[model samples]
Structures are given as structure tokens and as C-alpha cells.
Target: MTDRRPLVAGNWKMNGLSAAAAELDALAKALADRPAPACDVMIAPPFTLLAPFVAAASGTPIAIGGQDCSHLEPGAHTGDIAAVMLRDIGATSVIVGHSERRQDHHETDDLVRLKAEAAHEAGLVAIVCIGETEPERDRDQTLNVVTTQLAGSVPDAATADNTIIAYEPVWAIGTGRTPTAADVATVHGTIREVLVERFGEDIGNGLRILYGGSVKPANAGELMAVANVDGALVGGASLKAADFDGIIDAYR
Candidate 1:
């Protein structure tokens, strides 16, 4: 088997409130029952819920993270939360360059790289997301686009400890659609090759690559078992404890 460890990261996106910590509490309890999961598990919730969730999952192995963090230097950025701020709030990881941020905030690959760098500076693992739009996929530009984004968005300093890659087809996120296992294998293999070329064999091969886009319990087994797919970056299914655990069980 590959040296990469499986990493299942739940991205809560812009959803959740204080009341949502119950799910985190439940997940923490479940994790307590199984002290050692075969893979690492993470939950990136909305910023508003991080504190409460962290408090709720105090002694458990359930890691909490942020959906996004400001890449800008520490300063008065109004609504922006700096990477260090995320660290201060007990976030062990953060997702950078998510498609929603890319499309909605007009974040370029350069900006995403800066954010990832910032996350590393603050001692947080950065889960960088890359994907092709429906049109781009249809145009057969998926590989080219993804490789370009991978080169630009992934910092030269990335290491297994500080960086994770998630491939989420734009049209598939929350749409209940997914690429075939062969398709996932092809893309993930391509990504690994690029990583090995850019970062060298050892470092590149050890970085975890996760599949995202409508990931649910029913489809997780096949997706997780793909040649280069180390785990999943779950969305809606992650919002519920039962659903997320089921997805995590794919590794089991």
C-alpha cells in the first residue's frame, strides 16, 4: 500500500449555528468509542461554530477546522479572519481555495497559495481544493486546468504535515453526481505525478489526496478505494454524525 495516510475531512461550508455543536458532540462521542481510527478525521465548520464545537469535543480525537482563513497579513481587514486568528481559536486545520471561494470571491491561484502558506505559518494543515467546472470538464480541459491550479495553488513549501489536496468537480458538489472510480483514479494519479515532479518523490507521494463532490456513505467505499484516493472531503453528509461516520467507515 501507499505511504499516504487516509484523511477524511468534513467541510461544513457556510452552514451551521451554535445549535449545530450537537453533531460535533455526537461525533466526538463516537470517536471516543474507537480511539484509533485507521484514518485521520477532521471537521471544518463555519467559523461561528468552531469555538463551541471545540469546547464540545474537548477530550476527543475529533479535530475541528475552519472553512476558510484570510491569507492577508495580520491587520485590520474588517471581516477577514487571519490564519493566526484561526489558530488562536483552536483550529488545527483550514480549507483554502475551496471552489465556492474561487468562484464567489474571485480568488486566484496566487491568492490561494498565499492562504495556504499562511495556514502553514500558523501551524495549521491546509486542505486546498481544486476542480474543473462542468464546461471545462466537457471541453476535455479538466486535466490541464486541474494541473495548472495544482501547480499554482499548492505552495512550494507544502509538506504532508501542512497540506492536503481535495478534488471536487464543480458540478458534482451537492448535486449528487460523481465521477466514475476510473475517472477519479486517472485524475488522482495525474495529481500525484505532478506532485512528484514538483515536490519530489517522497514528499509528493506521501501527501494525501481526497475526493469531494456529493460524497455520501453509499458511494464512499468505491471512491475511497480508488488507487490514488486516500480519503474524502465530505460536504452535506458531514453535517450529520451518522452520515459522516458511515463515510469514515469506508476506511474500516
Candidate 2:
């Protein structure tokens, strides 16, 4: 197995409010009793809760991040949050090119690349998400779509330390439908191959490639055991402490 460390990140997506602090607190408590976990953990709450969640996670291993950020530097982008702003508020990472953002905002691969570059400029890790929709998969274009997105969305400046590749098939996200273990392995392996070809063996192999889409505790163990599947970018289940803790137990 690769020596790359695993990372389990939660994408709260347009969800959560100040009241979600209790969930964070409970998560912290749940993790406190266990020995140091084998993987890194993070949650990307909505912009409104970033500061408070970061504060609440202090002295805990959990990290807080922003759901999305503007590609441009801080300036006249009304209703847009810049990556630097996220870092300014103690958010160590940012999610870019999520399927929701791609579909809802009509975000293109080139735009995603720019956003990831901005995250690097602000010294924040960019979780670059790439995947195919159900139709694309059904047509056998999964590899083409993901690799193209990987090439276009992930910036040239990306390295293992500053960038993460999350394969989140658009169809499976939040649908409670998951790819078969073999399917997950094949896609992740193809992704790893693409990274190695483009970024070189050392940097590519070192970068952690996470699987996202309908990931829950019941399947967390099975999914995480797949070759080249480093971790998960949980959606719905991450909203609760007990469910998230159950998923984290796979690494524990």
C-alpha cells in the first residue's frame, strides 16, 4: 500500500448554521476518547460557521474549511468569498469544483483551475473534485471525463502537500447509491495513473486521492479498503457526530 496518509473530509455543502456548533462539539468529544486517529479529519461548513467552527475545533484534531471560494483575489467580487479571506479566518483548506458548484454555477474546468491556483496563492490546500455524471458513466466515458477534468481543473502548481484530488461521481453524491468496490478501485486506479503520468511519480503518488459520493459508515470500511482509494469526502452522513464518528472508526 502507498504510504500516503489518509484524509477524511466532510463537505457540509450549503448546510449547517450556528446551531451546528453542538455537532462539532460532540464530534470533538467523540474523538477525544480515542487514541490519535490514523487519518486527518476536516469539515467544510458554510461561510457563516467557518470562524466559530475553527475556534471550537481548537485543541482538537478536526480542521475547518470553506465550501467554496472565488478564483480572484480579494476585490470587487460581490457575493464572492476569496481564498485569502478563508485563510484570514483560520480556514486551512477550501473545496473547489464540487459537482454542486459545477452544475449550479456552470463552473468550467478552466475556472476550477483558476480557483485552485488562488487557493495555492493564499496558502490553503485545494481539494480539487472531479467526476463523471451518470450518463457519462453509462456511456463509458468515466475515465475520459475524470482525466480531462483532472487535467483542466487541477492547477500545475498543485503538489501533494497543497492539493488533494477527490473523485466524486456526480450521480452518486447524496443519492445513497455507491459504485461497486471494483468500480471504485478502477476509477481511483485510473486517477492515480493519470496523476503519475502528468505530475511525475513522486508528487503524484504522494497526493491523497479521496472518494466522495454517498459515503456513509455502513460502506466506509468497504470503500476505504479499495486499492488507491485513500479516504472519503462525506456528504449527508457528515452532518451528524455519531455517523461521522462511525465512518472515522474505519481509520481508527
Candidate lDDT values, in order: 0.91, 0.93
Cα lDDT tens digits, model 2, 35-151, are 777999999999999989989999999999888999988888899999999999999999999999999999999999999999999999999999999999999999999999998
Off by over 4 Å in 1: 34-36
lDDT, candidate 1, residue 148? 96
Off by over 4 Å in 2: none
Any residue pairs clashing in model 1, and if so which? none
| 41-100 per-residue lDDT for model 1 (tens digits) | 889888888888777767777788999989887887899999998999898999999999
Candidate 2 residue pairs that clash: none
Q: What is the lDDT of residue 141 in candidate 2?
A: 98
Q: How far is candidate 2 from the true structure (C-alpha RMSD, Å)?
A: 0.8
- List TM-score per model, in order: 0.97, 0.98
Worst 10 residues of 1 by lDDT: 28-37
